[model samples]
Target: MPTPKAPVRGRFAPTPSGRLHLGNASTALLAWLQIRSAGGTMLLRMEDLDRARCKPAYSASLIEDMHWLGLDWDEGPDVGGEYGPYVQSERGAFYREAILRLQRDGWLYSCYCSRAELLLMANAPHGLEQEGNPRRCGCLYLSPEEQETRAEEKTPSLHFAMPDREIFFADGVAGARSFPSAGDFAVQRADGIIGYQLAVVVDDIAMGVTDVFRGWDLLDSTPRQLALFDALGAEPPRYAHGPLWLGEDGKRLSKRHGSVALSELREQGVASERIVGLIAWATGLIPEPEPCKPQDLIGQWTPGRIAQEAIVLPGNWMDRLR
Candidate 1:
């Protein structure tokens, strides 16, 4: 694979709702290379905003797992760098500001719909999938006075009043991406908390993120986030959706089956370098990286070489001792 040019920042943002799995570790390694090879900063973000689900144990285990996988970061929650509040929960005010900006710009609105209503909307003949409509809420067109009255009455949530605009962004790996937008998306949930889409866009813009490297599963999400960026009148960043790690069952790895956690491999006595090597291999960073230590891997890093498809690890991959 071709090496990435110098000085281009990228990051690994992981949610602490669970352990750092083999899939998570692998992606981190690839993102590390994507940033490090270019002499750019690799930021580690703990996406622990979901207070009900995110546990401190999971966060600690995730950090330990990343270390075990030989992945390091130049900036992160633990180290406390220039981009402090590396955890999403700490950045609520920032998200509020972005949402408020959209609100003032007539690009967002308050939605008082209940979940049952949303589900019914989804089940409506015009609704598609469990996702319902891209433009779901019926209350998005409320007048300012009506919206203010609802706000006074403690309405449910705020939603981005998606504009009728074509969305497109150049994926560093996927080349050009284009999506026809039907409508706006949610910003804050009915529970008065920010959603992933809103917070991520706000965070990226606030953190001065120029580039994003994540899994292909989120490829569709980029367009929505880009639209949110447009609603806020801000330029969006470049994106790269790297390979995913699938199970031997040919499905993307998940907790439903065992072997999901990186710590599990450590318990099985697999060397961290071997794991890193497999990630590098799976992601097409190298056809094979000999001496797979994280330091060695980083030294030989190149973002342009990373693969664009989901990489399925061999069944016996975890069994082999390094």
Candidate 2:
């Protein structure tokens, strides 16, 4: 008998910093369709690591919005799973442990440069070099004594020592992608909070997520995450970066783009089906806008059907909905 294939597992992780905008909702809808279509398990993880901005109320509202759109998760903060702590803030110890392992394996170094100094260095003539070029930073060569001395003046952030080589991966939607191995990035901030790159990799690995579907904006960060996966001896998940929803100004959708938030639309009495239908139409999964539920789109959902270019919303897009 043939060996049984493992079930696919996917996740929809969002930061609870603000209300869910059209961009966020569309991503969530696609992610839900992908997992549900494959008979895979879906998980919801709240990226509430940034205590300063992430509000509990925002997370609660996000859960409500997901439900209103008929998107359901097999596991999430609201519904506990084997990965008990789905929230990033509650999983700090895991990140701390990963950082310690990286340090022991000689894959990490202490960065003592203050924000002002780093910004100044970046703006210097030498900093104009291409991103793939090796970044010149004296902090990487600091002696133990010098590091100790700098530690007294300012808390040192942890930086991953990036390998100088090219990293490549085949994205489900965007096709093959390549990134130069250059900049040594931080895994921990000066404030001691764990960084997004490190935290996301650690959580995904622990949660056994086999696939990640997110916005195209994060496509550049894939190589960095892949490098971390290698250092941690974990297989990276397959990624699908869907095109972003842009406003009339040709910029990524944001609050500045007008009342695009789902909450605001809900308050305006816009039906949830209309929101789901708009997303389906915008993503090229459907030809025209018509009221539909999340489940109604599953049969037609395919990664290739998604547009490679960002969808530009019309200046009067809101008027059509109204």
Candidate 3:
């Protein structure tokens, strides 16, 4: 972690592919609170990289939901700051430049594997960094003749060459962590879209983000992002992955959890304060599930206070708000 005096720039980036569910809103509240309590700059970014699935309507609705929950940001798509184009789809030029620089440094290579071939290659043995660690894809490293033939056939995905070394970083919430080096990963897909791994790192670096607070589900992805940050020669933000809100059945809380979406809650005339208050209580931010706003919890925000274990909420957890 940087010195306490260092400027803290944090962001809440949400993909505009779906409605903001309780899980999403709760995470956002935690992220907003973490940054706000530190008196840091908080940014909202629309991670609409997959343009085909992400819609402007969803983005607008998400902003509305956040506003309803009393969350505010200093920089975002609505309120432009130094980082003008906060939406991922508009940041292709930056990603392309990074790709060029990586290619020049021989840190990127072409991947021509088709969908079926890629699926079969999933089980292919990887160069292990340690026993029982997660493994990513190995480099294709095709010869000149094979490359020429593939170029004529289709556009190849540009993949970052993973350096065979362990990546270790301290998480503000999860504590000391380490991930074994695995296989190469794509920076750009064959369909001509900027890959998630590359875009996330590039966006955070460009926005001068100093802290990253997200859900526990994305904890494993930190190393891959850290690797990209290193390859791109940028200082990575400190990451903190908060516990997830899972269903009572021990599965991730998702669309299957009926009427838990912020939009649905609003449609049912549920007060935003009620939702925020219940989340604050469930996540161990408050002793009681009393009505409150995002700002109300900022004063009591603490890394230790956020629930550590996956919070298993029952199917009718939304009833409390009603």
Candidate 4:
């Protein structure tokens, strides 16, 4: 019998709070390019764990938008994989186990500070942002008695205790990066919610992810993740920070600036091919050519060709999509 091949895995995870936007579509395309170029398998996961905001319509639209764009996932919520239950919301027990493991290892503690209290402390005149051991909040200093008393009064949040050293890591796309990541960061909220830092760390480790391609906006969050990986004795995955697309004002593209969702763009008569072409142009996968379909562009797409600098979208590009 032939030996089983080790699957090369890449994933696209979108929250179901809204339809996918241009920026998000671009990201999905880039990730697809990377996975395709590697001849690897790609997966999709709905980051719809936030029950208060998640909408079924939005989730359906996300899948529909990806289908319109011709992006396919080899494994996901729709199709079962060895890693079933791809949605974070469905993996509650996994997170619970991770939290328990961290707690037993003395890597995490329970915090009981309210949001207002934390804000007041953070905004104090003498507030400090320490490097490796950045003073996040003084809540870490609370004695066991105080913690128990607070626990009896209400619920306590969980925090990951960071070490005192500069965290540095090599980026696959952006190159060597280092940052000061001090401060006791929250792992679980007082409302029994797991923070991104904690959730992503546990998920990546569990999924055996080898690479991570995300926007430059999340570059700052890398150090904290690195710290978590170190604390858990897990190897960090290869990292890449793709260039972010901005508006003419040079700010990040957001809904406030008329940055509609990807599905909305489709509804407004924007062709999926043009949207892919725009991303290719902006990311330097292919320079601005006259016009082309998404399939034609993907055939020549290369993830390594993405530029490091953020590209601002042109107004006429939207018109071209029409």
TM-score to true structure, per model: 0.86, 0.93, 0.92, 0.89
Q: All candidates' lDDT scores?
A: 0.75, 0.89, 0.85, 0.76
What are the per-residue Cα lDDT tens digits for candidate 3 across 106-197?
88888877767767666766554534333334335578888889889878888887777888999988899998775577889998899999
Order the numbered candidates by lDDT, best leading: 2, 3, 4, 1
* True-structure lDDT of candidate 1: 0.75
Model 2 agreement with the true structure over 264-297: per-residue lDDT tens digits: 9999999999999998988989989888999999
* Segments of candidate 3 deviating more than 4 angstroms: 1-6, 124-140
Worst 10 residues of 4 by lDDT: 126-135
Note the residue pairs that clash in candidate 4: 20-262, 132-182, 134-182, 134-183
| Per-residue alpha-carbon lDDT of candidate 4 for residues 165-184, written as tens digits (9 for 90 to 100) | 77888886788888764567
Give candidate 2's total backbone clashes.
Answer: 0
lDDT of 3 at 191: 84
Could you tell which candidate, 2 or 4, scores higher by lDDT? 2
| Best-fitting candidate, scored by TM-score | 2
Instruction: Give lDDT: candidate 4, residue 131.
Output: 31
